[model samples]
Target chain A: MSCIPQTDLTKNRIEEISSSLAEPAWLSKERRLAWEKYIATDVPDPKADEWRTINLNSLDLSKLKTTKLNPNLGSFETALPDGGKLPKEMSAALKQYKEIAGFIWQTEKGTQHVYLDPDLQKKGVILLPLSLAVNSHAGLAEKYLTKTRKFSHDNKFSLLTEALFNSGIFVYIPKSVEIEKPFLLGFDFVGNTCEEAVFSRLLLIAERNSKANIVNVLLSSNAKNINASPSLSLVSQLNELYVEAGAKLSYAELQDFGQHVFYNSRLNNYVHKDAHVDNLSVAIGAAQSKVDVATYLQEQGANSEVLGVVFGTANECFSYNTIQEHNAPDTQSDINFRVALKDQSKSMYQGIIRVDKKAQKTEAFQSNKNLLLSNGAKADSIPKLEILADDVKCSHGATVGPVDPEQLFYLMSRGLSQKEAEEFVVLGFFNKVLAQFPVPHTLEWLQGIIGETLCTQFQSQAELKAEAAVLVK
Target chain B: MTKTILTIKDLHVSVEDKEILKGVNLTINAGEIHALMGRNGSGKSTLSYTLMGHPRYKVTKGQILFHGKDLLVMPADERARLGMYLAFQYPVAIPGVSVSNFLRAAVKAKRGQDVPIKEFRAELKDNMTKLGIANEFLSRYVNDGFSGGEKKRLEILQMALLKPEMAVLDETDSGLDIDALKTVAEGINSLASSDNAVLLITHYQRLLNYITPQFVHVMHNGEVIKSGDSKLAHELEAKGYDWITQELVAQA
Candidate 1:
């Protein structure tokens, strides 16, 4: 399958996608309605506070063409087929995980491999491609897939993903089933042409009294190997998570796309009574990326914890918006987001904790911390608290500053050089948040990436200095 | 004959352009423990900070020599590598960096090479046991959320691990209780040797009672007005600082 440019985003493109996949009539009609909504909705107003930092004007929908999906490959062996080889870097990355219950690997073309432990299958766990699940479990698919549309109506990017998503995965954990190992879902975008666009979706459901963990990894082929302009490729993704009553779920996403890709994502978590959810997002690679994550506590005794770690370098820009809404009494929520920037990179974070009038005895908190590693790096944080209940405990805190000179001095006083001192402080700054990661392997992987990035930065600076000395001589 | 370890000649230092150390002159010799006692604003801490190359303490007009090498030109890390250590009165906390990791890095930097894991662990365990610190202290972040006594003990532990030649204990006994003071004093005594020297800075004579000093100097208004034997400490404890300051004013 290849990406072919369409003159415009029209109903014909949506119909073509639906017909090519032989989608059910209800889904096809839903796609047409979503297409109309996408066309009718206006781009986010640049003058607004949330959109001011993001420049969507540079993104032209006409230039991005969607790829046609191949037929779903169900129940593949442990090894991928000859034609379904992953990129070398992705393969190397996957080798680091020694234990996982199962994994589904997909590229822009389509799902390449799907694997699950037979024991899990016997226990009534369902893991398959979204396209395949729609046919095999039509009742469950239709109910949850349509539920996401109600919350994504006002955003242009969300509407686009709803209308044109060609690849996705569906995961279901039956009632009272507890799984110790996490399921890995890998998405690799290997575009060989400019303006290629990929829209992916994820639907996860943890039934009553169930427990599960899910990890989503987003990667892209190295741009230097392709003949197309790397900066022109686009990726849009949406995730829908449902944690039913008395259930528990842990979700983590690690995004390290190609160097020059434009990426956008949104995650919506619906947590029910007596349920708990732990969500973490790590973003380290991309030219310009925007993300929105929201958690809704819809019943009493519900709890949610959200965490984010962002590291940007070079001329990359990242923007994040988060919401913690307490819709029921005795609900609890907390959000902690940390960002570190170097070179001329910039970051913007906006978070709000909203408590309804009836959410008495609620506990909500939000905090965003930014560390600038260079003089040119910039960060802006905005935290808001909207509490309508008098008995609720709510607070928000935000900080934007460079590495503390005193901390650096304290470390240096122990005999470390300036560079080594700064590195230690920066790593320590992020370790506070990383210590909370539920999975040990994920924590180790993130630490390795952060360490490598710091080394690269320091090495380049040393090289520049050496070159200057040579010129002077 | 004992060798000269440090010399401060007509030293002048400033903080934010305000002179804190004015023409303060003193000297320390190898193997000798010296006590510097003064009031709150008498510039004892300022002198300690300046010796450790704190950037905020500008040496506007001063000369500090460590074993005949100019100390003012070197940075703090270089000063540390040159066998100079300062136990701050208020140790800054570095969150998320475990004590063991920080000590390992510091030891590597000071020795200019990495020590093997087995040796480092053994050394840490030995020192912790001697100082009465639990094994859990090694895994905790460096001085983060530590009680006053714990912070002071960690400082001494670092001094024990680094093994500097010229150590400066800047008001290390300020917030410690009697039991903690004895433990820290014992640690210092065990680490001291004929090849190294210590300059103990304190406000009261309480710490001097535990770790007896060979020489005691009284600093007033940024200058060492008088120097005497260990008896001077006992005298000051009995009569207080007013007699010394009054003697100086009468002479003027």
Candidate 2:
């Protein structure tokens, strides 16, 4: 391994990172090209509709470090340096999910724990760290990693992630192998004296006729560390999902970072003939977050559903851009995004449903609803529809307003205090989308986060366990 | 002697600076059912809203006493806790809140404690059976996509669960079919007792036929210009409220 000076983002630093990872020739060359593209791309025009609410100037890429602190790997039975003690949030999540097919935990240092069921491994399932996958399964890695370059080119942060991703995971399910349980992936960031930057890339491929569910969680250490001056962090994540013909995949992502973390994520789903993909994203943390999610129905009979829930409190800011693209005949897609803001929080939601000319018999629907809980809170919703085929059906709706006084009055008349009434309405606002979540653990986790954000009384771990037992019964 | 449950003395209310209830005076006693008859804009609904403490309906110069305590100073929720309930004419829909969950919360607030799940479920089941509501209605969102009769039934269901001492039925009989009206009227009758009173507001006398009132007051131009036994409602229903307005004009 060659040692390079950790300085600002530059061509030399990119080459050093590529060589240090000992990546294959093709990947190294691709990273160089992506670096070129990253430099050539311009910051979003401030006057543009999508960029008006987002301020990127505060993100000083040069001041953030991209070096991995720890390079060793551990297994589920024994995670190193901490004596097998997981972070509090991750430990809670682990206890919540009693029957998971696999688990992977990655911190700023490196992969700390990994576990896969022996049965799945016997069936030719491969779940490995990205750095190891490129060498052990180089052919598969090159194929999918190259395909991810075709999306989100206009996003400079996405290109930067492509060129300098230091940590990642690779998941592959062979043909006809159905995993009944979900795989849990956790990414944690710990703050130190310097402003650290994390670029995580995930490539998941569900082969033809295979099925799987994956839950990805992004969390950070304590807020006290994050609030320390000059100790901020920037997290840039890129996820590429490929649902082969007749395959099904359910992917849920929950982001709960600290107060000083700036988060940017881009997810692209490539769905093939007769394949179905359900994607749910819940964001309740982070100082500022910008997420781009898109699904491409590339073949006939393809279906995709996208759902998002965001609860912002304090001065947290969130922006979401979603697209549902139908490129073939008889394709269907739906998008529902909801956001609730309190205190001085702000949110922006922009969605588009695009149907190609040849995509006849396509049905697409998009809706966004925002609820503001205080005078200082604000939300902006913009929904667009582009249908090139006359035979296709497409519709979109958007609403942004404070809590309905009439609804509040109705609840109050039923005997709830003002605070309790508002909390009930806010939770109810998110209920429709939460009900569509594929995993029960994810739903419960999201509920906990929302309850904490609303300052509602939190149940103890024992109480939650008892509640789960009752639910099971 | 019957104890007084609600007393309104020289009650005047305004909505958006326009007087809606001009100097209304009325009294209701325990174990008594009072029917309030008026035209659409005669401030019958305003009086109900003012009693329940709706912020939009301001009590400009009025004194409302509930069980001998000042009612105007309390908020809507406090009034609810004080055993006051209003069956709205147009109950607002709360999406994503299941009927069971909302009812549980309301019951908890009214009783100042969480009802045991088993007991809550049993009571809900019993009430649903009585109201002709399906078992599936417990999980459905509150008033969302519910039929008019269903909304009215849910209102009465709330009354049953809360068991308010002073209940105001504001046009509860307006949108119900004959069968639904009978069911709701029966629900009201079952809940009324010697410890509670009912103030039934309606535009027609059809509901009184099912649930007879001990007293009926005809409100014309925000004032109770005529009061008598239930015969007063029958007279107004037959005479079309014209005779009362003409009598008031003649008296003026």
Candidate 3:
């Protein structure tokens, strides 16, 4: 395939990354093909209708260096150098961070560590690094990895990540195996490489009748509040999931990157007949982020519930796009996204529920509710529904407004301060979606971050109000 | 002297630049139940919300003293923490917050500390049972999808749990049937004690029949035009509020 290259990304860098990783010839070919697709797509244009609303023109993609692959490739739970000294950049974020699950921590320096349940391994569950899987389970990796979907002609970022991703994660559950414990993956960025743009891929597959829960947490070790710069940190990741017939998969992703990081991620879920997929996403930290979640109900009796909560503060910008595609008869999908923005933050959400022509008896629902905590904060919710199937039931609702004054007053009349009152109301607003989270500890972790954000935002708001009060005097 | 739980002096209030409470004054001492009855739009609910320090209800001119402290100067939450409560006529619905969770939060805020979960659960159960409330109501969202009677009972349930020094029931009897009304009134009557007072703001005289008030004050056009004992309630119920308005016009 011949295509004109649009970005400044060079083919030599792509080849160098592939050869340095010592990937198999077929895997190297896959990388080249993805690079071709990435070259064919133009760098996202701010003038385009889809990109006009998104603020990516300020992002200097050229200054972001490709991540360097660490040669150590240590075992799971390997200790860091310097007597296991914690990275200075991440000490504060760690203090506020609560442990969700025993995660496989992979840092930019290639320090990979994990605590996999041996009992699960005994039951024929496979949790291995993606590069290792490419060599050890090549057949499974080739068949399942990035095979369910093709690269879109317009999504250059996905193609870019697929082409140059040096660190990848792979999880597989054998037929009839049901794991009670969750599989956690942590991608932590360290070092002072603010110019490094990290690309990662995660492939999760559940065989027929198998069930598993997976949690993917993306974060940077740096805690300092930094501004967007030409050398700003960027983490672009792609997750591909396949649930076979009668299988069940519960997947969640928590994105809390550093203050200066720009994150773009996508999750594509392919659910088969009689299968079920439950997805919960929580986005809390990032200077600017764009996330997309799409669930395809490909067969009858397949169901998916998508829930998400976005809490942004300060000058952060976040945009989330979701699609619930029903392609078969009797398939159902429901989506709910709740967003809270404070200070000068901004959030944009665009969701669509598409029922194909043959999809009869399909039921899909989409709802987006937003809360603005300050006058400078803003949010846009655009919900669309395309129903080609006449028999399908589809409904969508989008609301963008401030926190309900009545709810605030109600909470206040119960003895909570204005800060506490707003926090409680926002928490309650997200409780319905969080209730869908399978793991209890994960819910607790999300609630903890939400509480912290609310407190910080309210404190700043009080200070601003005091300043204004003084000016009036 | 019996301590006054709440005292309102020359209180003038407005909502959306329109005057609501026009020079209203009242006082309720501890251990007493005072009934303030008025027709619709007569500022009965306005006074209830104003005394509770609602932000929109501007107190243009007045002083609200709760236990000798200036209530108007304090935030609504502070007043609530200081042992004041309002049973709203149309309680706001908080969709995802369950009744039990809301109560626990309210209790923690009121008491300024965490209530042991076990103790909180037990007290919630006790209060719910006392109000003839079912256990399932505790798990449902606060006032969300609740029937009118259930909302009233939940308000009573909260009042029972907080044990506020002064409880203001703003038309708590509006949407209740006779049986539900009796049950709610009984719940309020039990909470009235020597250390606490009850302020019942109602338009109908029926609620007083179940929970008798020590003082009955007829509010006409935002002022307490007449004051008497329990007999006053029956007299108004029979003669109707028209007589009070007629008497007020004549006096004016």
Candidate 4:
């Protein structure tokens, strides 16, 4: 672990990533400027909300590399209908990584893909790699580069992401054009053997009357296999999902990383008046992960839905930070998050709904529910509301407890075993959060995964109650 | 010895520091039905609960023996599995669990093994029909949004499925209409067996009209004051609790 020396990220790596596609010089300069912004912004120093009552000194980010896009060495193959059906176009976009308006890391073996519908290309849509966006579409890229993401936040991981940042795509849907299919990018992160780390960045600009769905998935395979052969992969992606007077945008990120690496991600959005944005982030599995997602509602009827779901178990740690900003009058935002914990796993949910004075009639709601099924498992939810608008309705609540005993006993008495009874109670506990996001199949998948984890980390009441009494008393 | 299944000797119990039963004693043998009738708060339901060993009900200077073994020594679940069942007067509703699943668990707990799916469904359907329960009720949550009569029917339906050696029907006829009363009484009558006994706790003598009891006992302030044949129930119903109280006062 101590044999490797620290390396500094310079303009060369950024240029190489852009020049690999022979991207014009202007885009390369913009990449350099974005890297400079990465330098200027400090890493985040988590406040009480992020790490309350928890210790996280084991996260060290000093010795890591800014890696190149070494796509996974394999053709896409999967019966799973999601992103597997279109391998031909995906591979075409994969090789032209630097040429596309938006560049993203694919989940399959360092697979990287881009989105460029020929029709939109004919309409002069400046969608390509972030480097190209900076060089070729400098005016638009600079104005929106770090507009949504907070890279300057005080944190070592943020600083590392900024320092080593290189990959990710840039997308801009020109005025009055519609792209029906979702834009997807997968990143496979394996830090060890390759000695290369990833800090992928994305910039998305949807002009007035433009419609699109950008779906990016972050993944890591254990290929760079050796332990602390450590390549730090941090992705600071920006989604300036502009919904001009009449535009619509849907952005989603799925983080399913290798069970042995650290994943640091930050995503944010800025929506304009009369525009709509929906952000859905699902984090199913990860070794150690931190996600920051927020949306700024800038004008009247500028609505946003910020939804997140996470699963944490065994030694996994999940920290989530969400900020919903209502910056315009009649603007609305809804934020909901649910976490399931088992074994020694831990998850912290800290979210705030802020309503500025000018943002009157802003109705904001925040809720966090945690299901703790093990003696060693722990969950903390810190919900906050800062309202400067006297006319706004803002409220937040958090709940942490074991399943209801009476409810469990009642079910057990009917014919269900003790385990079956508890499963029902736990499912009922998060029914409210599930209602906000009407995706039942995803909810069922999450429920099954949690139930299996509960089976392993479970101890009967005799074992847990006695242990709890001794500790609390 | 006529195979006495339940033998209560001076059973005194209290719940949460309040005395419910004071020196109550009763005995019933298999192949016979015993009816314990009393007014409200006479400890009729309390005796049934204490017999099942509810954790909150502490037995004070008493012994509840079923088939010559102490009932107070076992947990509620074990008591249930040991062939003793209670048909709750007001069934407790458990949300988010289907009726079929709940009944299956109770049966398994009593039988101590997983029942085969085919046989389980056939028996469950038969019991539901016997209790006048609709097939759709099996899919809904346990007693959630069920009517008063439906809850009572479900309780008795459980009694039929568990087939306990002895059953304590606590006011199972309280909230039933004429049709429901007839249906529930018929269901109970159909389950009667020479190998099992029934302890019917009620506030009315009307239910006994359809399903006759071999013996009847009058409970006053936790003790059985009078015991007689089925005609005793008719005589009490003809008059009222006041008639017996007045007679006792005259005798004293």
Candidate 2 residue lDDT tens string, B1-252: 889999999999989999888899899999999999988899899888888888999888979998899998899999999999999999988888889989999999999999999999899888878888888888899999999999999999999999999999999998899999999988999889999999999989899999989999988788888899998888887789898888888999
Best by DockQ: 3
Residue A222 in model 3: lDDT: 63
Ranking by DockQ: 3, 1, 2, 4
Per-residue lDDT of model 4, residues B149-204, tens digit only: 98998888888888988999999988899999999999999899898999999989
Lowest summed lDDT window (length 10), candidate 2 chain A? A75-84
True contacts kept of 1: 0.69
Chain B TM, every candidate? 0.99, 0.98, 0.97, 0.97
Q: Model 1: residues >4 Å from true position, as ranges?
A: A6-8, A72-75, A79-97, A221-231, A462-473
lDDT per residue (tens digit) for residues A1-473 in model 2: 12223554666766766676778888887778788889899977866656656556656776777756345555544222232376655665666666777788888778878878888889999888787789889999999898876764578888888888878999999999998688888887765556778888999999999999998888876665544444346889889999999999999898988877889999999999999999999998888888999999999999999999999877788889998899999999999999998778888898978889999999999999999887898899888788898898888899989889989889999899877788788888888898887766777666666766665321232366679999999
Residue B94 Cα positional deviation in candidate 1, in Å, after optimal superposition: 1.5
The alpha-carbon deviation from the true structure for residue B95 of candidate 2, after best TM-score superposition, in angstroms, is 0.8
The 10 consecutive residues of candidate 2 chain B with the worst lDDT sum are: B230-239
Candidates by lDDT, descending order: 1, 2, 3, 4
- The CA lDDT at A125 in model 2 is 90
Residue-wise C-alpha lDDT for candidate 1, range B130-171, written one tens digit per residue: 999999998899989999999999999999999999999999
Candidate 3 residue lDDT tens string, B1-252? 888888899999989999888888888999999999888888899999998888999988989999889999998999999999999999999977888878888999999899999988888888888899999887888998999999999889888888999999999999999999989988998899999999999988889889899999988777778899999999988999888788778988
